[model samples]
Target: MSIDIALYDGHPAGGRRTGARMLRLSSPGAALDDALARHTDPARHRLGRIDPYGDTLFDERDAGAVFEEATALLARCTTEEQRAAVRELRDLLADCAATPGSRLVFLGD
Candidate 1:
């Protein structure tokens, strides 16, 4: 399984959405899931709740919190792949946080 991350111009509504400005990032689902599962406190780590079987949306308002959580997770990454993936997530979250109407979505499968 793999997870795909993308950044969009605004909140995507149903089937009418424009192309995302940022290139989508894909990472091994198991690797990310394992890293998140190892988080010591999932209750406080918002990113840990990413649904591997569904979609996870983070809008501009959620960017700060998501970025913080991603930073924390990045610190605990045991493998290079995990670190790289979380780093990409952090970058996307940062962009979303800075853009007024942008959103980040994690497509899981």
Candidate 2:
């Protein structure tokens, strides 16, 4: 199983600076373990600590839930642009599920 990981920048309201790297793993159990190891490894110098908040990995089941949630969110969008952005997010989530190993990242502001 091949895992694809990506880093993204994001900021939450009234939150400190932060960053995250998303990890998509084909083999859920094994890939999750590997991702944790890589995150904790000092040599890599990637992340400081794994933040539980806003951090999640979706397997088949979780992916389904996310799809539903994303759809609902998209439905609430008032503008076409907002809807499109939500649609893109939905597609990314779907791609992560489809790929054997895939990941995504949302960095802090």
Candidate 3:
């Protein structure tokens, strides 16, 4: 199954249903999942706490921390595919961090 990390124009939880999708990154296999599973500590790694079986949402306020954790995770990736996926995630988080009113959502299986 694939997992998609999508960026939206505004906070989806606040009844902003019409927000346009700004970007979307998809993980085709277990690459992203396996990398995230390696870091279980929530205090140190926010990205690691994402539930692969459910949905996780992060607003512009959380983009910085999530980007940091994604960057850290990228450094630990051993495979090119894994690195690629995390890199894309990191980039998306970076963009989300810079854009106010934006929201990033991790859509899982």
| lDDT by residue (tens digit), candidate 3, 48-81 | 6787889999988898777777777888888887
Per-residue lDDT of candidate 2, residues 1-84 (tens digit): 222323222221213354333332222223333333333433432222323234543443444446666666565556555555
The clash count for each model shown is 0, 12, 0
> Could you tell me the lDDT of residue 59 within candidate 1?
85
C-alpha positional error of residue 41 in candidate 2 after TM-score superposition, expressed in Å: 34
Model 2 lDDT, full chain set: 0.42
Model 2 residue 85 distance off true place after TM-score fit, in angstroms: 0.4
After superposition, candidate 2 runs with Cα above 4 Å error: 1-61
TM-score of each: 0.80, 0.44, 0.83
Position 21, candidate 3: lDDT: 57
